[model samples]
Target: MTTRSCLLPPSIIRPGGRPLLSTGRAAARAALIALSGLLWVGALATPPPSSLRGADAACVNCHRRSGLGSIEGHIAIPPIAGPYLFVPRGERLAELGIPFVDTARINHDPYTDESLARAIRGGIGANGKTLNYLMPRYQIDDATMAELIGYLKGLRVSPSPGVSTSVLHFATIITPDADPVKRRGMLAVMNQYFVDKNNAVARTKAPTLYSSHTTMFRVERRWQLHVWELTGAPATWEAQLRKHLAAEPVFAVISGLGGSHWGPVQRFCEEQSLPCLFPNVEAPTGHDSDFYSVYFSRGVLLEAQLIARELADAAEPANRVVQVFRAGDVGVQAARDLQAARAHSGQQIVNRVLPAHATSKDLGAALRDVDAADALVLWLRPGDLSALEKVSPPTSRVWISGEMGGLEQAPLPASWRAAARMAYPVDLPGRRVVRVDYALSWFRIRKIPLLAQQVQADTYLACGLVSETLNHMVDAFVREYLIERVEMALDHRALTGYYPRLTLAPGQRFASKGGYIVRFSDPQGPRIAALGDWITP
Candidate 1:
């Protein structure tokens, strides 16, 4: 029921006639602890006595709710969990029933209650060295400080259920609506990646030590992949995912496959705080606040932006833009995005949505109204593109989705190629030949059928990314750390297949940023030409 002013330190008066601390330094240290421990106080001029979650909020922002800490640029925020802080410099954490993390310093001496308090108040480590400048000094009373340290001692991060001394388990999800070819391709890449990983680890005689320390050594753990194939309707996918996750606990979801709706899968990952990285889905969850899911791009949404940019800058743009898509498909979102983008541009946007299982006969109805003064935007799959033979396209301007229509191989008829420009969200085919063909060669060697080229290539890239991140992680198997490491390492990768260059950061879920608007160079063939330089719109 009591509150304290944020400007002032922890109350000087103690309840029940008890001394908060024996010395003035200890009292100041407690106030310092309270100041550093609770971040919410800074936002309010007056904070309640219970603000730091009172005994429950030892590690706040930056360290995160997981207490696993985070990295920014060159600064490594050390883990404050019980095992990381209390263990001796020469001791192995795993042996002490503690999980290992690369962020935890093994060379640092162990901390006692008194030394820990001194370090908290004075900004000095147990080794008598000053801590990083990013770490702030705080002020709190003695009793509260003792309670905070006790809370930290109680915070422990033992290995998750999927992690073990000899193996690390990961799951790849496949929705019932996912394309069969892409599913097969993703699983093939994941299986091959695991086999290659174990073989490489086997070559090393022993787990390599990170530094010249007896306590620190990278334990060789074989990668284990669990396939979660979800059946039934989209509404039930999240429940099915929960059941599968409970039945087979995986450290994270990697390189999955999905179709028109990946919302259930996205929800499952967000709710569980499970890392779902780079699943091959055209329409991914658009919520930017969700941290657990990352994608290669905004899928069709990025294409919408690309098309909108082209439309917005035209010397004499179309007076009316007509967009056509399936009723319940990912294209629906893409069409809506384009409409919103060009809303105030004095262009009348029209949406012609066909049924989910629309036949070729239905194409005529959607294209009937499009004419010379209107831009025809097609948010459709290869089947729908092929169905366009039933009707002629408008003479104004035509934009087709390269991703949904199968990239350069989009089955648009020869008649349409001269007029239609594809929203190509990857590097040009000629430039990406070496990058893509390298994966194709590997597929041949492994005897994995290359049915879905883009899906397979992206899956291969995702597997390689996970492997590289784990190598950088050393022996740390923390789930949150894995996601953080992937974010940091993605930008440095030089061999990103399919995509021009993949990149991600703290809040960025999509890796590839932009693409080109291209048209068929020759009417009869698969070769395409870009209209201009890359645009990130």
Candidate 2:
């Protein structure tokens, strides 16, 4: 055994062969050091390559391994790759133009990194136009921006296997300054009805030819009174609308008609002989015609009945019913519901109408008058609900209930937690089928504090219903509109989930009906409830 000197460099031993520090070896060593330095400099100067920085990587954390596909959920951000690449690059981008670019043509090329940067940062498109009002302007630094761009560029555009590229376009004409809540409500309802992603047909500050094209396409058009806020006089809105009509023929209009400006839009639709669907607006008794309105007046009455029924059901069967409502339309509706309940349920029903601006003390005094019934049904706006909740007794036994609109616009104040139950219509974030898997997954994964709350459970229920209903509606619509294609895409079992197989009929509107009974169980405690399909008893 020969003892090897550990201290000696390998170069001395290898000198007879390929020397460690030979001329070629020295050149290679120098090259390696220089390359390492260059790489370090590049890393520092250029910012880590966006792929390494990880914004898109973070996105994939939720969107999943295949960038183009997603797990089912209502708020599930759709895959950005695959066939729907048109969504981000074509549709959403075109709809939300590039700020300052103003190419005049729609979806002109060069939807580059800079254009996307403007959209994410300034909420402006490359075309110098503001984007869809809903897109939140995220605060992204240059490094993150580079990363996002790199990630987007890396995305493959090949359509996902088994996915189709065809998209159904449903247009809605909405006012430039539409009420956010109402607009959201409308979108929520349509989402439930059509089971389609909400897409804007066209947006305009003035009623322009662009709007006319949208209307002719029978897009859900939203007309509002605030157009006056833009032009001082309502006439400017009319003029713009006329210009749009001249360019594009319109079919019918869906009147969200409210305030003063409704008259013009309504008149335009009427002149065009196009049908208008107005929610809750009634037609003349015994007269049937093409134009229809679902008036708000009926909504008030239906809501009142809904509240009365819910209160009666929740209370002890023997408890008498008393309704506290404001004077005018709301008061009358409450009175009718009480009368109907008295006739049907045989429970004693009483009505108390307050002045237009009734105070807390007044409501408290009226509330005290009722002895036989501990349960009270309020038919008032959110402000009134807030006031009443404050004044009412805070005990679990003393239950107060009302309709969806009865609760204040904001979250229930701390003090009123245990004292009230309010009816709420299902909406996107609240109640929809798409949320079920997501909520369950979130609860299972992070154990988020908010998810631990009982209110979140109620929200989960609402979301379930929304998803179920939308799935049902879309399935039906597709069966009627594109039967062959839908049947080809899904199996019979999948179709059953969307539409009841027993009642498969073309062009039939499947009513996806549901409501929630949200009650505060304790003050500063937790809100709890049961929600399901709203079935009339």
Candidate 3:
């Protein structure tokens, strides 16, 4: 039941109504199929062409996981889902409840099972014309062709959950342990953004015709945001999110807030196939293998790598590394990450874990034995940093977590400021003014108080990005499609608040990849200077 390429010349089409596929010809055909980005039916045992990577994902890459197909430059990859393929000519897709997709071809004749098989076996279409060059011909067996057609027929055509004719519902998750001030700021931005989005749309719920596409009509759907606040321990957070989603079904989760433990929420999103976009978390937990949970950056985990890179490329080699952080905080993970990064460097790495409710005395005890030869790393909060005034830095080679300690505004006392270099994950303050000002202007107009500048700006950026992606999507409200569109749309963003640049591709979840290592310029205030250029560790 293995699939074979139907890219043979006319002389070699069939000797006796069967494909004459030799080893070299089969390999050559695989290359052509790979290049054409065609769907292969029942090729589970077939070895992919050596030069092409992700051969099995060819169809998904072109037609998309939603089967809604994408438009690349001038090329239109038409939707292949059952409704678009099998619907009789002149029947409005809206009448059949199929959401309008820009790439759908409504004028084409309907595809019968036999005609569809013919299209697959040759480069012909249901209308007796040749298909697009992007579509590769496949010589699939009758049984496998039937299975593939069945699979296409089962592809979801209706609008995703939380989508109505005139309103689209979205949710934002807030963990109980999240910072109250930051949560308030993020919510203010999200609420205001949603309000502005809906207000800009016409009051009437009339459906307007899509551009140049007569069969499909676009309805202006108002955006609605639901705030899902999770309570209790991290273990219970997932269940709470599930309950919230059940009560208020949403197409996607956007611009949420989390504290040290976003793992539960991240897992819940992945398991449910929900798009959790750019959540603000001190420490984001997940692997590149994950699909649904995307973040602006890796958070403190990225800072650890930045610090590690510094340590590796330092002019003076350190005899030992001393890391300090409070227990049960995101710094715990950051410390571990740095330790892992320095594993093969043959340096002595010591971790000083303070009590959850530690005091100045506890901080003093942690830095008790550090000396000039040692490289000290602090993964502490503002309170812990302020207390450092009492305990002078034990080493000149000191690295601090700008994220946990409050970026350029970290309250490292004057004595420690001169000695410590901060791992600033976001764009340098001086460089990002114009980009950040856009969000700040929106806040000022809406009269939303600027409590947490970075958090609010990031939330606004997330909302803008989602809105832009949706605009490109037109009326297709598929969750997978939303995520895919976000990945594609991120690179085109000119206003990436707090970040120098943001980009994402398939399997690349983190949008902003690198940061600058900075040192405080003055003893007090938020003034800072970059020690060097941005480093992507």
lDDT of 1: 0.76
Off by over 4 Å in 1: 1-38, 41-66, 69-74, 89-103, 106-109, 113-122, 139-151, 201-216
lDDT of 1 by residue, 297-372 (tens): 8889999999999999889889789899998788998998899999889889999999998888888888887788
Better of 1 and 3 by lDDT: 3
CA lDDT, every model vs. true structure: 0.76, 0.38, 0.81
Candidate 3 per-residue C-alpha lDDT over 219-330 given as tens digits, one digit per residue, 9 for 90 to 100 = 5689999999988899998889889888999889998998889999988987777889999987899776566789999989999999999999989889899999999999
Candidate 3: residue 483 lDDT (0-100): 83
Query: What lDDT score goes with residue 68 in model 2?
Result: 31
| Cα lDDT, model 2, residue 506 | 15
Per-residue lDDT for 1-537 in model 2, tens only? 111223323322221112123234333222222112121223222222222221222333333322332323333333433223223434433244211111123353345568767755666665678754333444556754554454444444332111122322222334443444554444433333333222232332333454332232222322111111223344565566656545443322332313213444444443432323332111111112112211112233444555666655663664666667666434554456556755777677777778866787777877776654445666655566566555645333333333323322324555655555665433322334344445445444544333122223322332333233324322111111122112212222222211112121112111122334566544543334544444333
For model 2, what is the C-alpha lDDT against the true structure?
A: 0.38
TM-score, candidate 2, is: 0.37
Q: Cα RMSDs of all predictions? A: 7.4, 26.8, 7.7
Off by over 4 Å in 3: 1-57, 127-139, 202-211, 214-216
Better of 1 and 2 by TM-score: 1
Pairs clashing within candidate 1: 30-140, 30-141, 31-139, 31-140, 31-141, 32-138, 32-139, 32-140
